[model samples]
Target: MHATKGTPDATRFLELLRLSVSLVLIIFAQITITGFVGFFVVFLPFLSSSYSPGSLLTGMKFLIAGFAFALPWLGYWWMMYSLSGNGRIRGFFLLLLTSYLALIFICMQIDPVYNPEAMIPGSARESTFLVCMAMSAVILFPFYSLGVYIFVLRPVKRPRKRYRFLLLCLLFAVAGLVLLPFLWHSAPIVYPGLLSFPE
Candidate 1:
């Protein structure tokens, strides 16, 4: 009788599948919670009684902002799972963090004014750009550092030159940082207050 390594292999595969499912569940839950909070807090009050372009635009802003709020954490997990290499992960994390902040800048530019009372956890008019940027750097740095080293792109006796990969990461990070400010500054068409929420 031959003993087999099949059981351990099957168990490992199942574990990986479980982790993937968990990630999906986490994303779904985040989207749902953000959607509800965003609706009452940011969207509802903004809808208008009379249909208008401004109101439509405002509604769009809410949806975009909600997605933007959800993107960073999702992006983090996505990158964490997808890539392997400390330099690459660090670069990806930086780039993703930059992009996430860019979205915040986008939301700031949309700058829809809403009544505090209508919102569940009310928002403020000021830009959260800096805050998001700071948070991204602080939160992701350690994770990026730890993750890259742990996940093997290909195990090595000695590390190989990965300058090109590092350069690419830098380029992405720089591009994200540079373009976000401009995108953040562009003014939007209208504010749809009251209709989205209520009196």
Candidate 2:
């Protein structure tokens, strides 16, 4: 009797552990994808031009900035996932957020080519962008949490279906798109220079 009783508990614990590990893997994958995309986009412009010491240095700076920008979001996602206790919901939210971030970063990279002033480090515009990104994160966190709670956690008359998750994802994507312009406007410019670069 005791052995049978313990089996289910042990199995449940193992299942929770598996979910936790899977979430961590997803987070790491997100970070890796963002880093690769950032590096490639930043390096793309230099490919057509003659190699210069400055271009090489700029590429390295972009890579570092990409990682720095992504690390905070990783923590935020991990915390949200742990709190939500719904791997599917967490995955959806992370996907949405990562896509939004990648899009913004790509735009930032392209913007500097036409308007060099946009990428100037430590400038007011750059600072506003960072502030806006941070603000977006703060604003979206609760919205996602509540969304998961209402859509997935709360009891409903109808049986929960996979399509509901898809719906939630679509809704979030739309909301993200609606707010993206504002976010992008306030987004910190990623310059091809080091943090210590003279203002």
Candidate 3:
């Protein structure tokens, strides 16, 4: 078997972009669902207490959550724009998506709303939502993964400073996973008066 080493296919990279766009759209749809249709689910026993156990989770609530959850993935895609190596690009994005989803699931378990009964400590309904979302995200990974590889193959040189910033962002990305638990645990206590549906 011969290994091919060179620039990635531009068409394939475009496909990854499309996949990323689709994932973003899906996240938006979830925002709408949790916002507009969430009321019914919120009223339900497990659904309400499951993820939004702390306070009422309105449409806006899910919108922000979805955006925040998707940020890491989005940031990663953006970061790829800076580099021109297809292999590194693909590997990095794959790592980013996987790591981001992992952190989300971990936070769900650590947070309150996800698992209300406290039957399982460090596990909640948020985790369940993330698990499902990650499954959906899995469908798009291949394209984005290919994009990363394509990126690495491209011919270009990065500035030293930009490289530094990319490195910083990468570090931040890793730190996000470590810090997510603390953020989830402290968010409610830090900010009371969570938003709710109109009375």
TM per candidate comes to 0.28, 0.32, 0.27
lDDT of 1 at 45: 53
Model 2, TM vs. native: 0.32
1-199 in candidate 3: lDDT tens per residue? 3335686777778978966764565455434433433233333444344453233442234334433434444444556544534424544444445544543443344322433345743333444333333332333333433433343224355644345445444544444444444445555453222211111
lDDT tens per residue, model 2, 1-199: 3447436677668867866675665556545654554454334553332322234443343334433444444454445555666553444554555545644544444332223455533443333333333344345544654555456445355657345544655565556545545555444343333233344
Model 1, CA-based lDDT: 0.40
Positional deviation of residue 4's Cα in model 1 after best superposition, in angstroms? 20
What's the residue-level lDDT of 187 in candidate 1? 21
Candidate 1 residue-wise lDDT, 1-199, digit = tens: 4437555566667767865565555445444543454444333455432322224443344334433543444454445555543434434444444444443444344434445565453332222232233233333434433333343232344354244334434543444345334433332212333123323
Clashes of 3: 22
Best-to-worst order by lDDT is 2, 3, 1
Local error of candidate 1 at residue 53 (angstroms): 27
Candidate 2 runs further than 4 Å off: 1-135, 188-199
**Cα-lDDT of candidate 2:** 0.47
